[model samples]
Target: MSAPPAPLSELPLASRQDGSHPRPQLIRSTWADLDGTWSFRHDDADTGLAAGWCAGLPAAQEIIVPFPPESVASGIAEPGFHRVVWYARTVSADDVATAGRSEHAPVVLLHFGAVDYRARVWIDGRFVGEHEGGHTPFTFDVTALVADGADHVLVVRAEDDPHDLTQPRGKQDWHEDAHAIWYRRTTGIWQTVWLEAVPATSIAHLRWLPAGPAAVDLSVRLRGRPAAGARLRVALRFDERDEDLGTIDVDVPATATSVDVTVPIARQRNGQAEDELTWSPERPRLVDATVSLLDADGGVTDAVSSYLGVRTVGVARGAFLLNGRPYDVRSVLNQGFWPDSHLAAPSRGALRREVELIKDLGFTACRIHQKIEDPRFLYWSDRLGLLLWGETPGAYEFSATAVQRLTREWMDAVDRDASHPSLVTWVPFNESWGIQHVADDPAQQAYSRALTDLTRALDPTRPVVSNDGWEQQNSDIITVHDYEGDGAVLARTYADEAARDRLLSGMGPAGRRILVDGAEDRGQPVMLTEFGGIAFQPGTRRADGWGYTAATDAEDWIARITALYDAVRASTFLAGSCYTQLTDTMQETNGLLTAGREPKAPIEQIRKAVRGRP
Candidate 1:
């Protein structure tokens, strides 16, 4: 069903929504892409500020927005370490102006999807705002800066310390050259930068929590204060099935910044119909909803479009359940790196293709290791029906400063991405990263538990894994990583119930205890979160490449992986298993597919092994 025409004031600034739009989860009709060529230069000596180059730069080379300087896609593909970089872009009044809304003044909001380490922005030599996180997004209200029709030169100074281990730098190498498990750095703006106009009063944030298959709770935060007798209208429909589920209208309390409303599914339907409305990897159903703020006169003051996916994710009876049904998770570890672009995907299509590729491998889920992935990737994951365990990058050291930085950024990420239906769990740390002394140190253990508790507090819908794949406490799932290539030996550990119990009690895979001492095991589902990293080169493996194990041929690779998967499936104690990786990353060649995303072996056979089928 085609959407009713949006108000002229809400005319679309872009043509498509397949990933070009940065914030796909919550979209407004007014926005523009600032993702092409931009004036850029390297600040090797950090002299840009002292030299007063914010207004403009001298002989600045061109680089692509949303692609970091270290990437080939960016015009300047300098490989060596560069600590600081700058980006300059021009935005016109039209870029930030909503069509046909002249009476009620609109505010132009400049948005950055992400930038590395730290970013300080200046508009026409005037300092605007600064943000510190590299993976999540930040926005600045630039209405005053660009209210005049004259063009505004937006300057951004991005500072990333290549050697800063205390920061949450995920898999980005500090070394000049990319090496084992670490890829090149992403400096400066690495995600779509855009502008949009909204009423002075608009929706600041929107969060959806499924109350069940039949209802959802909406946490709506207003950008500006509302007058008395204001009302919120929510309309839900499934565009794919042309099904209009229902609508809800609620009154907003005066002078309130945040409000909560519960919406029930409108039409009562049969079991099959309700099931059809429910989301799963097989169906991937999504209900599009438009939320409008109506004033006392019943005119729309502001409106935003979002989607809802009704499904339940939890652990019960020692099994992972989707919609309360047992779900055997076939998942892969995703680093989300491209050969040409490193951390930045080559294009919007690449993000969608990544999700498609994971689904193509017969895997139902992915654990985005180390990195807080791009929002566009999360958008595709939501639309395409692949489960995700959202993780933040870990800082190498534990300090009060590190704690503050990580906690702030992690909360921002949780606030930004929790609405995604595919994000089924929160994993704060991995293998005792940042909290290296978690095994023994009380302070470190508290830090880990604090993150888990904090994440649960922010978004309580999903489970939390304080630390994955090692010395874990207060984790919802007991996850262990073992590269035991011998399927028989691996099977004896995970497949045997007594061995599984013993392993959970104290003994862990690879000499890393699954649960730290004094942490009770609440009969949580056990998963071999990482295994079967068999690197196969088809003809010859790279001499410098690394994997948990090596395979000489397609036959050998398939047999080993199949045996390992069968071993994991052999256990009644096991809820799921995740393959070590989806694609080869940098110097690591354990991927089922190469870094270029080509299957090393026959795709069908690999799928069979992943699914444990004939």
Candidate 2:
């Protein structure tokens, strides 16, 4: 809004895009995005015990919000920023007050879109809360600690060891191991930073499930007691002028832990039942719903708004399907890395630009391979209409114990992002990273199957890729990757007998495959999910082993991808195909966009090869 608040590299670590012809804003709902100047400093240690931790810690260095400390977007691209760092900023107490207040609201929330690994926040030198996961968003209420209207200081201490023994660090290499795949790390606050004012009895999280036709079941959990004899009523509104769907009384006892409130979906103006709006590549429709918490006497207690779409995704007929239709997903493998910002997105505009570029290139979906994308990306996909296949970051080791914890964290990620309409599939393990004794290891295969089953249990609306290019397991869509084979070898290898076994057994790395002829159908189709990474040389000189080059220049790259896409399309046995990438990420120059999001390969070449050429 306000001139995008200078470049993230020039400001502090606080901070927090483009295509689709006339695409809608990707966010499910709009809110103030906090990405401007904030006070920042490097923490001296992990204890957060530095003197003058409150009342602002010295200089007013303007740190960019949302870009992570180590990123160029943070205005401080100092290496090893992930080792340990401290940040401090200040917000007003008046900021938390409502237009009309009794002067007694107990808590104020300081929200961080995401903080890598671990974080401890102090308000006025009083510890408020600590968070462990780095890739997911978290919030803390600092009301009790800060003095009202006294200009309180907020201190944040964050630590991220990319090579840590326990945490999950996807594709992040601390050192300069910028070869194939691995990229750099993003530490500290890398997402939105803001504060929300809520009543002491306000609602916390919402869980709304759309069950049956044109109806959604609802449950709201709140903090503090409801006003005496007050009854909570929930309403669903679809439009500004539409009549609110009649509110339903929420039954909650004083001792109750949660309130059960069911609000009916709205009916159309023409008297027909409101049709369920589901989101998919072909037709993306989102329904906006606002939930208002009412007191027993019909007084409005608090209201928080959110949006949802009624879509079903699953693996069927050997391929991922949406809304019961056979959806052939043409995807680009997205690494979620940036040259300036590293793992964190440089800016919201940058995220939108990347998604728009992917769609413009005729790709219908993206494999958010390994790293979990920022919520804003999912927000855009849900709003702007892009399909997403999400995967867990590969860990360094695996076992029954390790896999169990990994499974839980993976499920947590799914729950965190369950409401977005763009997410179509969940991938647990990729290329056997961290997997030990996978081949011929029944235990490993079983571990994979268990995780897949776990995903189904968590959210059955989407399909599960139990293992992608790892030893076979019970999965919905059968997926594989290919890179080692040349043009002729790749073309013929799919039909090879040995290759068929490998495909069936879900074995083989790039360039080689073994297909199975008689494997029982899991009701899912087959896909060469990762292939066609034909690296043609860019015109500029690239360091040896730094870029992809099956031949040279954009033309060669286009030819190879075109051939691969044609072969895949011609094969009736293939369900879909995803190119190696959407953009050239970091050292992997095979992407359509150079690392800087500049210099795209010839669009005509991609259209000729990928779009209707076959």
> What's the TM-score of each model vs. the native?
0.96, 0.84
lDDT of each: 0.84, 0.63
Best by lDDT: 1
The all-Cα superposition gives candidate 1 an RMSD in Å to the true structure of: 2.8
Model 1 misplacement above 4 A: 1-16, 97-105, 266-273
Q: Write one digit per residue (lDDT tens) for candidate 1, span 52-102.
A: 889877789999877888888897899788889888988776665542123
For model 2, residues 456-491, the per-residue Cα lDDT tens digits are 887766777767764546667777777743656666
Question: What's the lDDT for candidate 1?
Answer: 0.84
Error of 1 at 314 (Å): 0.8
